[model samples]
Target: MSRTPPGTRADYAAFTPITTRWADNDAYGHINNVQYYSFFDTAVNAWLVRQGLLDITASAEIGLVVETGCRYHRPIAYPDPIEVGMRLASLGNSSIRYELAVFAPGNDTAAAEGHFVHVYVDRATGRPSRLPDALRAAAESLRAPGSGSA
Candidate 1:
């Protein structure tokens, strides 16, 4: 299988800083592979919260992660300050694809990179719903040039 190249800081539209917790490390002595996904989730949702696009307790709509994948280029461990870079890869009526990269302090290239797709659904009905205008606008602001849409 072919591997996707790691992205540079310039490729992302937004960034979130992450602190590596000691418990995030695995028996192998580096952050567990699964923890990378948590970083991705935190980065996206935090951005949404900051934009007032999400109110986790009472929002009428919520984004449910539908798909996720990651590629690791290097190991990062506890105490290493990292940053997660984010960009919108695609936007759809009911879903969005977020591409994210993890950068070690001072590095321009990613130590890990991946994507996750979130399908927006009505919180009470659990059915797909069109994205709210504010939410859509917030997402659009994160789109890098030449990104996708549907």
Candidate 2:
């Protein structure tokens, strides 16, 4: 509902570079709205993997995205390099909310911004579980000091 982008540099403590693909553009001649979500997902999970917090294949505790929303301010097309800025808003007993911003090359403002809530669950039971200490620690490191927000 905000004209201004939601996630910004102050909100993200880490960054991941992304390259737009030729196929990512839609008939509208810009990156499709849905593709932004994919980029959002990829950036967050890639961070989790890089930090050794998420085990996509074998961990008993796995995160399932329960909610996501995005706001697009401008179009991002192929052939341009981008950076996805990311941070952890909070770590609940069983869930974590990640703030994300997609920035085009050389742009200080974001093209799209979003947040995703991932609920950790037991793989076999599909029941919510307390976030692992390691996972929580990893997520906390990505949060900007004194900047956790809703």
Candidate 3:
């Protein structure tokens, strides 16, 4: 099987810094693989919040994660100051795919790279919903060159 190459910081359009908790480490003395997904989620949602596109308590439209996958280039341990870089890989009527990279402090290349897919849904009905204009614009701001509609 071929491996996907790690992404560089320039490949992303937005960035969010994340602190690794001591508890995030596992018996292997590194951040557990599962924790990378948490980082991805945090980075994306935090960006949404910053853009005023999401209101956890009252937004009528919410995004439900539909898919996620990661590729690890190296293990990162607790206390490592890291940053998650994000960019829109594609956007659809009801879904968006975000490409993310985890970088150690001062690094230009990623230690891990991942993709996360979220399907926008009606908060009350839990059914798929079209992306709101504001949300679409915010998402578009994170699109790297060459990324577009899904």
Off by over 4 Å in 2: 5-7, 145-150
lDDT of 2 by residue, 7-125 (tens): 55666788999889989999988998998889889998899889887778888899999999988888989888889998787778999999889988877887888889999999999
Per-residue alpha-carbon lDDT of model 3 for 1-150, expressed as tens digits?
Answer: 987678888888999999999999999999999999999999999999999999999999999999999999999998988999999888889998999999998889899999999999999999999989898888878876565553
Ranking by TM-score: 3, 1, 2
The whole-model C-alpha lDDT of candidate 2 against the native structure comes to 0.85
- Which stretches of model 3 miss by more than 4 angstroms? 145-150
Minimal lDDT window, size 10, model 3: 141-150
For model 2, state the Cα shift of residue 62 in Å.
0.5
Reference-based lDDT, residue 24, model 1:
96
TM-scores across all candidates?
A: 0.94, 0.91, 0.94
